[model samples]
Target chain A: MPAPRPDGACRDEELLAAVILRLIAGLRHVAVGAQSPIPATAALLARHLGKGQPFVSLLSSARHNFFTDGGRELFDCAGQGRVDAFFLSGGQIDGAANINLVAIGDYAAPQVRFPGSFGSAYLYYVVPRVILFRLEHSRRTLVNKVDFISAPGTSPPGVYRPGGPVALVTNRCVFAFDRQRGRFRLESLHPGHTLEEVLDHTGFDFDRPERVPQTPSPSPEHLDLMRGVVAPLLAEVYPQFAATVFGFTRQEQS
Target chain B: MSAIFRSLDEALAGIGDGAMLVVPPEYGGVAMEATRALIRRGLRDLHLVTLPASSLQADLLIGAGAVATIETSAVSLGEFGPAPRFAAAVTSGKIRIKDATCPAIHAALQAAEKGVPFMPLRGLVGSDLVARRPDWRVIDNPFAARDPIVLLPAIRPDVALFHAPMADRNGNVWIGRRRELATMAHAAAKTVVTVERIHDGDLLATEASAAGVLPALYVEAVAAAPRGAWPLPLAGEYPRDEAHCAEYARLAATEEGFRRYLDRYVYARAAA
Candidate 1:
């Protein structure tokens, strides 16, 4: 059997780094919202891939508030009708493809508004394909229907919405929603996650893969790039990110 | 051409002397003149009350000494150019940077949009941003029953400039992706649009949905100049000029190098 990947063999940062590599391998562009994980990962991926993605390049700029700028190629928002794929993370998303970045309850005083819809509001309208990637999926975070459609899923799919939240990549499995109904269905499972694990987190009944396949593990070449190219620069460009995501130092191992 | 501007001077006429222009955010600087035409303008003494700047626009604002201070949302404009010098300046009291976030800036611009004195906000609890900005007053949630809220005084700029994919003669702006920035600008004062082309309603006729991408209500003037995003790219327009961009990257590596490049390009060529 192939040697099992060990935490000691790879840093904690590799989890996110590898995920980023996996997401960015074939995709050309990915829009990142404020404090959203997809953009964070795409930023690292761009650094790994190279520079010059338009809006992706100038993330701090309001113009790049939505859309992907992988290297020099900037993808337009779905509303303006320009996007191939994008990712959404760091917030609770529900079955209807609606999301909540504001307070769990009321817009005013609430459990937590986390951070008002980064770009989910408009991104929901504009970006054609938005992939929701959750690091932590729990019953508390994942719901049958999101409290708010921070960004609408298919926006009345109306026979030709043609664009909406496409995939939801989580720690356990990959899922997709019906174009018209915005219902959830399991697409694929990660290496470590199981059907029960997936069931435990989702609030709705989902169509799972009959013979689910293992989540594609990061290749060694991808890992080497993750550790060497991504990790090193991440340390220089975003040291805090490196410290937080890849916290598997000797202290963590111990 | 947008037909809005009959002259090149009009095309490059957003910033005139001391204009309190907000650099919004650098999400591809969609608001910037294509190919970053603002870089070619070389304005000085621009009042930029903005976010924690993190990209080249932040660097350019600093380089031109135009940034008065920032009531910012973030300083993370992607990893490019030098680490923002404004943060250290604020910490050292050399510059005045009122820390805020996107919501704060949005409220400020909203206040501008409404021509109001101030707007109340929710966040800014126990944040270093609030502590850093001595002028910012945090008080009881006047809107709410009990909880406290953050009050950001209205900040209406004299003019606002943004880049768009296309615009019409009457100042109807249409953006490519999301219009978040456009909304932000709409909430600000005297909106100016810089677009790649002024579609004459030929192909745009069929694109009826895209006709009024940006309504005439907010935009005061429209400049339809191709490649307006310059270093940035418009959806169907030309991408960034890599050669000029490479030269910029090389020159902007150091303060001296940046200064020399700026001097050669901005200072020397007063007519640029």
Candidate 2:
């Protein structure tokens, strides 16, 4: 395996993965869905750091999954509270945490159609620590109000919702969800990013502290674990991401 | 107790136009070969239901103008990218979409399997999916006061179709751990299957094998089509043809390109 960066600087994806690791710490089970390499990396990293305390289930990898009952088992397990953490992304996310994965315009006549909601509606309500991850931080993606609500961030009092958004992780910063207020509070800005930059890109209003801390860089131990231990495992499911981020290819591992 | 093993055409004859057909996800034994045949036969007004989500199969059918309605949680090509045909069709208002969540589809099928009217599921209270789907009712939980839940109507499809690794003369299919196929077969009025090969021995002959077998009781017909799930992986048998899928994604991006794809892959290949 290639060594960690000589400059001790972590790549953007590595930093995102490290952030996910911190968010999902101490969870019993973390399930990474299809098309999420950074979250998958974080789940695997957490497994290594925690000495395999939390079982990692990658939906795309036959090797990483433990379910024998097929695709429905994941949703079934999440329904029963077996899954502790899961990831969700959207074409548009609002201050209230409503995610739009369906379409951009009217339901009857859409301007842009996204992939239909894939278990997000239920998983967001059942999985206690549902982490919202969107790599792009822009006005278009972070909207004031979504065109459609694939899944809402908060529910009414009578709604049997045990799971909801705990935090929204973006490329610029992390915004922790205030479930009570139905709003996002800016938690921290990532390295080389500013509060003004985040505000400029954001379309929705969010609360921020007077003194915001910079999102910490991954420690040397975390970087080594991500590169040496997690990268190879991730290559099994996300070969393209592994190749791009860690410079590790499946052929080399084989 | 023997199954009516027929040619692929004969096996799929019962699935006429305007039929509500239920299918599996991309990973769960997709019948790519059969999908191509359906397009070749030029069946129309198909109310296609995906057991949660789908990818290439759904996209191809939509691009072929075979599907009039699609009931699915999502249709995406994973790493290859968004399903071009599906996106285009939906944006153009070319087909009716019954947007669903993964669990909603599963629970609805399970409800049908048990011959129930509907199944009460947690979540989806605030989602527009419930609002758009008038068939999905949100009722106060009978067991608990002030608790609301969504109840999905049982989806009893006209036919269920998929590819499997193997089937025996008795029509018992060994699905391994993909038990959702069993649920689909149970919920649908008739089930059609295509297998890579027919097993000489009875799938139910051994307890180990019988555990994963979908009995012929639900199956209407079976046909043998080796590598039936081409382009898509069939679990233990083969990995997905990523190169082919990427090529498909590139070619299926436009109407003209999609027609070219049809000419090369679907129309050119003779149905066995």
| Number of the top-ranking candidate, with TM-score as the measure | 2
Model 1, residue A169: distance off in Å is 19
Write candidate 1's Cα lDDT for B1-272 as tens digits: 33455443464475665667665444333554321345556555556655223345555556556555544444433323222344333434443444345555655666766777787654343333455456567676544564555577877776766676766666666764445445456656676777666766533344664533656666667765555555544444544343454566667655677777667755564323
Query: How well does each candidate reproduce the native contacts, as fnat?
Result: 0.02, 0.83
lDDT of 1 by residue, A1-254 (tens): 11345643543234444555454545445555444433454455564566644224324333233423221123223434555555665356777766664435543233433433343433444456667777677887777766544455654312224446777776667777776555777866766678888888787566765787765665676565554554444343233344455431211100
Let me know the TM-score candidate 1 reaches against the reference structure. Answer: 0.52
Cα deviation at B174, candidate 1, in Å, is 1.5
Superposed by TM-score, candidate 1 places the C-alpha of residue A170 at a distance from the truth, in angstroms, of 20
Relative to the true structure, how large is the alpha-carbon lDDT of every model? 0.53, 0.91
